[model samples]
Target: MASTTPTQIDQAPPVTSSGRSTGRAGDKIFAGLSKGSGILLLVIMASIAGFLTYRASIALSKNEGNFLTTFDWNASANPPVFGIAVLLFGTVVSSIIAMAIAVPIAVGIALFISHYAPRKLAAPIAYVVDLLAAVPSIIYGIWGALFLVPQLNGLNLWLDEYLGWTYVFDKTQVGVARSLFTVGILLAIMILPIVTSVSREVFLQVPRMNEEAALALGATRWEVIRMSVLPFGRSGVISASMLGLGRALGETMAVATVLSPSFLINGHILDPGGGTFAQNIAAKFDEANEFGRDALIASGLVLFLLTLLVNGAARLIIARRKDFSGANA
Candidate 1:
């Protein structure tokens, strides 16, 4: 037999001249579509931000008053003057109240569903939560207007009679349900399902190994959750809060239905105080003049800024936690 040469052993498979690696045609198409879709989405977001900013600057340039500090939102005529202070305050206050009411209850319900409820019960409960999310904002607004408003008169009466010493409860009972407290309650109800669903999913994702280890070490169920589940899902909880807050801040119809429109800056939740940006825009945009439209756009710019600030703060908190954990590791 002829001896095999080293050259023959060293020989490699032939390659096509094209630099592309071999892959299925379908896979290549899918990859291209995915990348193109991402680029398209990014471009769309950037364009929207740019357009809003440009319009807002034009509006601000035409106004004579300080846009940040003024309490009123009258934007009717030429050289129109309006500010976002009252609107901004209302938006922030209502959202804060919503979160305060929603977060704890959401977490508790999520925890119960994931850890305590039977499998059959859990599925139905989760379905109910998702259904709540699917309910239209307009429906919520209508319900708030018709049902919630009527119910709140009794609440208002109770607060006025029992808690009258407090400034928040000191407002005269107008027999109308339109108040900041009512809006806050409605917002809380709307946002609760979102936070609950997120918290449930996150809690369910906890590692069984970590939980088991905690259990094996003579830890109670509550202790195991405290040691392993809550800490592991802290970031998820924060993300859920931010998501719920986004909804609360931007919700127009529901708030418009529940809150009595006002231009004054007041310190009490029970008082008819001020309107949010979404409510203000929705209530008056059609009636607004050219400069009024521009002013509304400027107010939108303030809301855009607020969203950016909130997201930035959340990121900072997440980043600092990551750094601290890395250092400890």
Candidate 2:
């Protein structure tokens, strides 16, 4: 064989201005398409915000009630007096209750599926949980209205009897359990599968080597999970919780069905009457005139802003603790 010259061996192909070695046309096209898609999404979001703001301003200009403090929503009256105070309270309170109820159970189910259960058992359970997420919200609404509402009456009574001192649980009125508390419970059930699925995926992504190292240190299974798995998946759990909360906040039919709509912002969640933003819109939109529709849109805008704030807060929390670890070292 002939020996190759050093200059010939060192020779290389010329690169384009883009600095890509091969410079394939398809790569540039794909990159442009991805960037364009992202920009399109931002544009769409901006357009929606601007449209809602314009409509809301029109409605707010004609309002007779204090938009922030007034609890009544009488959008068809002489001056079209409407306010979001009750809606705001109901939405936030129910979502908080749902989060309080769902997150722990979801985390437990996720941990069980990821670390505790046998493979055969976990596989079926995970499949079932994912399938539950595919069920329509309408079905949950119907179920909550018919079955869950009646079933919860007993629990509501129990809470009223035992935990009545808490003020929030005090229910002096006698009626079916169609309160914000019931709505919250229904929301918890509705959001459970989504949170569980996301958390399970995050838990399953924990490195096997980290788990094994924890075990090598003579840690129990729970201890291993606490030391190696949970810390890695904490941000993911927060993300999952936020997703569930968004669903809870925006849920219309279930809250409308489970909660007997009311304009009053009572502290007794177990009492039968409260309204969420989505519930109010669904219940009132058909009866609304042109300005009333705009008023509803205003409430929708507030809901949008609330969701954005929640997501931003969650992202901030995750960013601040991105390096958190359960292990001291």
Candidate 2 wrong stretches, greater than 4 Å: 1-32, 318-329
Clashes of each: 0, 0
Which predicted model would earn the best lDDT?
2
Instruction: Please provide TM-scores, in order, for all candidate models, with all chains considered together.
Output: 0.85, 0.87
Error of 1 at 165 (Å): 3.4
Worst 10 residues of 1 by lDDT: 320-329
For model 2, residues 146-202, the per-residue Cα lDDT tens digits are 999899988998998999999999997899988889898889988999999989988
Q: List the residue pairs that clash in candidate 1.
A: none
80, model 2: CA deviation in Å?
2.0
Give the per-residue lDDT of model 1 (tens digit) for 1-329: 24667567568555554656656677989999999999999999798789888888888887777898987676775557788988998999889889999999899989889988999999999899888898888889889888988888888888888888887677664548677778888899999999999889979978788789789999998999898889877887887888889889989999887788898777667776578989998888899877788789888878887887777776776665564333233
Q: In model 1, how many backbone clashes occur?
A: 0
Clashing pairs in 2: none
| After superposition, candidate 1 runs with Cα above 4 Å error | 1-28, 315-329
